[model samples]
Target chain A: MSDTILFDYWRSSASYRVRIVLNLKRIAYRAVPTDLLTRQQKAPDYVARNPQGLVPMLHIDGQDLTQSLAIIDYLDATRPEPRLIPADPVARAATLARAMVIIADIHPVNNLRMLHYLKNEMGQDQAAVDAWYRHWIAEGFAALELMAPENGLFGCDAPDLTDVCLVPQVANARRFELDMAPYPRLTRIDAALQAIPAFAAAHPERVKPA
Target chain B: MSDTILFDYWRSSASYRVRIVLNLKRIAYRAVPTDLLTRQQKAPDYVARNPQGLVPMLHIDGQDLTQSLAIIDYLDATRPEPRLIPADPVARAATLARAMVIIADIHPVNNLRMLHYLKNEMGQDQAAVDAWYRHWIAEGFAALELMAPENGLFGCDAPDLTDVCLVPQVANARRFELDMAPYPRLTRIDAALQAIPAFAAAHPERVKPA
Candidate 1:
């Protein structure tokens, strides 16, 4: 009860994004793992608590919040320092557009559930499934490489919501073995994000249960 | 430009959502159709302007913007009246979560590009593609029915971002002929949205090219 509890999976890109935000904001949160591999997200109790049956649901201030970006927004709203969304309207819109390139476009298409469907329901082989994953990441990153802030951050001045989304999707790209050579800017931003203490702490390898 | 120009397609659920928001806010915008069927979004000029090659891109206040929700956020931030995001932190979180259920979960899976990939790349038949479309909408709506606000709106006492996302998704549901009996609340809320002038004015049929 003392710490904000995050119901998350270690390898979930969406969960990873929220975890980075929590660490960035210095908000102490208990990590309660929801094992997607085991289909634990579908359990009656879990489904009742979060109807979306998605990981990265947060319980804080006696309220339940779901959706990684929404949770990040809530954290930013409640804890205004280290602002995740930019102050300028144009910059904010640009940052969000960049973030959505990952959140709504890339990650959703290449997520574990979609990959599973591609393999099982669609009868795609490992190679085909892997191709599907890399294709999306590559397509998304192609655009993001152009749109990312030129100041070496994904957003202006500092790592904003776009950076939070970028690193996780980059991790997914590496996991799927997509060629990173094409997206130099995204790779540079991801490298920068990895150096940040908050992002380093939230790495899936660090959060993965032994 | 005499008015803000929205690069859009009549049948695009994303553009429809933004159109509803513009109407709700009483903002006048000129709709410049981007023919997705002809792959106009991928042409060199269009891709140069919007690297993502997605529609509902807005040219406003001497700035070019992409992504529907991001554009809506930009509108809300600049206009500040009849806010799309709620004032209360918790309420805003809830609203955004519901919106993501559509934006991230449902819409992305059913978008035209995904359907094209399923058919052309994966050799999915019309029936298979239809089943895929219906599967995602049903799964998402099952949860949204529970998470949606009880006052017959998707957010505090009125339609907020969640409703903006919902109505268009429901329009998609109808277009795909998904059974509506399962989500009574969503149907009721959609019915409410249809009565509002803003939502009605943005219907695909009205905006379709003659």
Candidate 2:
């Protein structure tokens, strides 16, 4: 089999989400850390490969893919054993919608570049920056909490796309010290997913470079 | 066929993307204008239906779908005549990645609520808010311009998901008075897309409630 290469940052929520899927599928690949703090993703060579210059770019099957959810979709499409996205149309739409609550609405606003812009360009202090971060999480999670099922994980017996997206964002929420009291369902789901070996192995702290 | 209803705001870029696909597929539907400016989306009743309280909540196939891309995915899956998202895995990933540069990165950061927070909560004047809007657009567009093909539309002969996403964001850029001189490729693509009847009919101006 050809080698799979994942260019990712350990601390990136998007990257973390991809890692969980890779681990869940047991797809062995080399992890090339693209440090976002130092802006290594913007290097000319990296830009040549990924025009967006974003991390979590995967090179597999001789194709270079960008965007976390897109990459996940590609992964799910090719590796169908433990499906991350549902195959049924309605089920798939529900899963994608819940997943996008984080991918589109919450994560983008709180990602490193956005935070950097708020602090450097807008002259916001750390407190304000943290507030901005928590604000988005609060808004997104409130809806997600409502959408979350009362029974099992996001995929209801197994982890699906929403579960993959949720773990990383929940990790970020804790990193920013956002309160978890209101999102009991999410907090509980995160806890259950964490106990699963695949999700646990992909934690940012576990993968962080020395 | 059952009735198709879309709860969307005329000016919302996310809502606009969904509109393009619905028109392209020739799906007849009722568009209920959920005004963002008056905080109509945040009303208790709307929130009950769409827990996210976001525009472009679609009702079809006896299901309520949120998130523009997810809704679009559902549409493409059910209505396969003019595929907005590619069926081939590699092509789908590339299309989705390009589309997400706008969907996930640019639009979310510059959405109505984000702008409202900048002005009201963060005390940013209109000028600062406008600069913030232009900054994200410029960053996202620079990457998208690189990914855009030199020849045909985003899908070559027909408009795809990337084209669906690009037209609305380009509309937003023009609304904000952004200088489009740098992104010649994107400008060319947007112009070509707008010439299509499906793209033209989805314009905010055409759909805006009187």
Candidate 3:
């Protein structure tokens, strides 16, 4: 069995991002589905491995790595093929900035835990939670739409970190029924990325347990 | 006047992270205060430069950069001295993972805009908003405290990305009156980090506009 083990939830956008990177790099790993809906991720055994008790914790290279972007950074650094992040400093910064719009700005606000807090702790209804999710997605996508290139993938040619992050977020956007008309560029990019075998294989539907 | 211009808001944890990096690198740049309180970040002129409409946008090397981590990555790549992110792959991943606990998980949820949404849109009261803020900080710090070193700076000798990210977050925690007693390791590290000139000069109170 491959030493790399990814503890991830099927529907998590963060986990989806890591799965895309792992597929792109052709990294083999055992998948341990830690169902977020069931709070399996917060189990003592899992929390011992990941103090954050968050999914997408990758046990690889003898280190337990948490955080999707950090894991991708490690993969890119170690594998160094089909480079997800650019080598040029300017290009790297620009690419990462785009990724952070989703990673830091949008996804966190819309994360399941945050949504749960809104509902359980703050007494928000389903409609309120759904609106909350859509609000952040639309806000981040508006900026991303402006930032998207007029042509080619986000990385230009093969997909890069920006594309890796963009695809999962787009999936979440669609799940939330966000209006895609305002983000034609991002929609085009997501379509192109989805066609890539690496991204296609990482789709949560493909990995979901029957 | 330096060609590099940093458009940032005082008291912004994300912006404070960038300020620490710039000071550590001894990079001279003009500070253009973009007030968040008045929603100055959404101004069209600023949005034209940074489509994300976020502060901590660094106009450096003739390129406009947004996102605090991405801006720091750019600075680290160019400056190279007092390197914030480690060169070793495993070390880099570990450092980044620590930083992301606060950056992606905590700060994003407790950000000004998110708090505004809870209070204004979700109709949560000030007490609810404060609880929301503290809950995330305590959760993130709990994880980080476990990951913190028993002694020395986060980088052993000098501050790295994790340390850079931590100082600003600790400041925010104090602002929200989070009881730091539980996170002794993180609290110790924050104390050491605060003594550093770079971190001290970047404090929100120090940099606040008259």
Q: Which RMSD values do the candidates have, in order?
A: 1.4, 1.2, 1.0
Ranking by lDDT: 2, 3, 1
Question: What DockQ, on C-alphas, does every prediction get?
Answer: 0.86, 0.89, 0.88
Q: How close is candidate 3 to the true structure, as a TM-score?
A: 0.98
**Comparison by TM-score, 1 against 3, better one:** 3
TM-score of each: 0.97, 0.98, 0.98
Q: Model 3, range A1-210, lDDT digits (tens) per residue?
A: 999999988899999999999999999999999888889988998888888999899999899999999999999999989799998999999999999999999999898888889889988999999999999999999999999999998999999999999999989989989989999999999999999999999999999988
Model 2, span A31-82: residue lDDT tens: 9999988999999999999988998899999999899989999999999879
Looking at model 2, residue B104 earns an lDDT score of: 94
Collision pairs in model 3: none
**Better structure of 1 and 2 per DockQ:** 2
Q: Per-residue lDDT for B1-210 in model 1, tens only?
A: 356999989999999999998998988888899999999989899899899998989999999999998999999999977888987888788888889999999898888988988888888899988988998899999999998666667655667898899889998999889999998889999998899898999999989999
Best model per lDDT: 2
Each model's TM-score for chain A is 0.97, 0.98, 0.98
